[model samples]
Target: MNGVLAKYSLNTVCNEAGCPNKGECFTRGTATFLIMGKNCTRNCRFCKVAKAAPEELNPEEPLNIARAVREMNLRHTVITSVTRDDLPDGGAGHFASTIFEIRHLCPDVTIEVLIPDFQGDYVALKAVVDANPDIINHNVETVPGLYNAVRPMAVFERSLELLARVKERNGNLFTKSGFMVGLGEKEEDVIALLTALRNVGCDIITIGQYLQPSREHYEVVEYIHPGQFKKYEEIAQTMGFQYIASGPLVRSSYYAEDGFNYLKRANATAGGDV
Candidate 1:
């Protein structure tokens, strides 16, 4: 998987973000493709992706990613990217093109894009929404109280609004958002965040432990237990999320295909799509 992604000059969040599940996912013949560029404009403290001047957009990237997906024979392909605030449309066109190319090359595959906030630009967000991927995910990496330390440049309200706007633009779309626990957030704080997500009509939610990328990054205040994750999942499900994935190793795109399929089956059983 590493060699193939390198051959196509592609990146994956699983690698760039230092995801804990990358080794397992790679061994299973799956990966979350990263597009736009390697460097991110926003230097979120919890992130491991390079924080520097971003590279110029690669016009051939969409086709390269499509070919890689076809070669990998991925039934469900996940695409994410660095926060390219330097770009006018925040790399939305690149995301759209990649979706289009992947759809053309692998018509049977399901596409999931875990996108940046586009700095709260509705037009930019709409560009990707208009592309019509199977699931659109934008993670609010930490709670509001921890945002200043963990994600200083990101706005929690804006992230919620981004999810809200996605639903408004296309009600049929399965909008999703996620946040990390163990960042000094109380149980009430987690519940509040879930309420905000539910109010915005987010269909899916993910909760994970906040593992510090390095000593230079924000410290992980605690390592949330597995049982706590289960409790959070129960709370989210009770609050009406169609699906929830919560655990210590869970990331926004972790086990994403399974979550989507679970929602599909649940909807089918419930007599209609949520």
Candidate 2:
């Protein structure tokens, strides 16, 4: 998997973020492609990606990601990027280009993009929405109360708006978002977060435990038990979420294909487009 990504000069969030499931995902022949550049402009305390003046956007990155997707033969590809606030469009055009290129190469592959907030630029967000990927994911990351401490640069409401806007633009697209527990959040906070997501018409939700990346990063407040995770899933299901992935290791793209397939089956049964 490493060889294939390197061959195309590609990067994956699995490697960049030191995801625990990388080995398993790679063995299963899947990965979440990271594009634009590895260095992020934002210094979110919870993230492991480096913070620096990002390098120039590679003109060939879109095609390269497409080639890598084809070579990997992924049934569902999740593409995410480090926050690129420096760019005028926050790399939304690049995202569209990458989506377009991937469709050109692997027409059958499902595309899910875990995008940044685009700094609340609707025009930039529109660029990605126009590309029309199967799913558009913009994680809230944590409860609203923890935003300043856990995600200093990200606004909780802005993230919610982003997800809502995606559905408003195209209601058929599967809108996904994720947040982490173990961030000093109370049970009510989690419930509120879930409620907000559902209110915005988010069809899918992922809840995962927060693991401190380094000593300098945000500390894990508590280790949530599996039962609690299951409870959260049940709560989301009752709230009308089409699918939920809740567990310790359930990152945004974890079991991504499973969620995509589940939504597809449910949509087909409901006589709705997927």
Candidate 3:
């Protein structure tokens, strides 16, 4: 898998974000592709992806990603990118191009894109929505109270609006969002965050523990127990989320196909095209 990624000059959030589940996921012949560039424009303190001047958008990226997906014979593929505030559309057009190329080359593969907020640009967000990816994910990353400290440039409400807009534009597209725990958040904050996500008609949710990337980044406030993660899963399920994943090692795209597949089966059973 690493050889395939390198051969295509591709990047994966598994490596960029120091995801602990990379080894297992790669060994299983799957990875979440990171596009646009490795350098993020935003200086989110909790992220491990490099914060520097955003790199130029590679024109060949969409086709290269399609070729790589074909080479890997992936049934489900997840694509994410560094926040590209430098771009006029926050790289939304690039995301749409990638989604189109993937569908053109590998029509059977399911696609899920973890996208930036697009700086609350509804037009930019609509571009990706119009492409009609199987799932659209924009993570809140943390509770609203910690947004200033953990995600300074991000607006919690904007992220919610992004997710909400996905459904408003295309109700068939599964909307997903995620947040990290152990960020000195109280139980009420977590519950409130979940409620907000559900209120926006988010179909899938992921909850994970925050691991500080380096000494300079945000510190881990608490190591949440597995039981607590289970509790979160239960709460989200009760809130009518179609799918929920909660655990210490869970990332936005970890076992992502499971959620997509669950919705697929449900929709088929209900005689609706998903």
Candidate 1 deviant stretches above 4 angstroms: none
Candidate 1 local lDDT, 34-141, one digit each (tens): 898889999788889999888988999999999999999998999999998888999999999999999999999999999999988999999999999989998987
Winner of 1 and 3 under lDDT: 3
Candidate with top lDDT is 3
Give the per-residue Cα lDDT of candidate 3 at 195.
97
Off by over 4 Å in 3: none
Model 2 lDDT on a 0 to 1 scale: 0.93
Which residue pairs does candidate 3 place in steric collision?
A: none
> Candidate 2, residues 74-93: lDDT per residue as tens digits?
88999999999999999999
User: Backbone clashes per model, in order?
Assistant: 0, 0, 0
Give per-residue CA lDDT, model 3, range 74-97, as digits (tens): 999999999999999999999999
The TM-score, computed over Cα atoms with residue i paired to residue i, of candidate 2 is 0.99
Give the clashing pairs for model 1: none
Ranking of models by lDDT: 3, 2, 1
User: What's each prediction's TM-score?
Assistant: 0.97, 0.99, 0.99
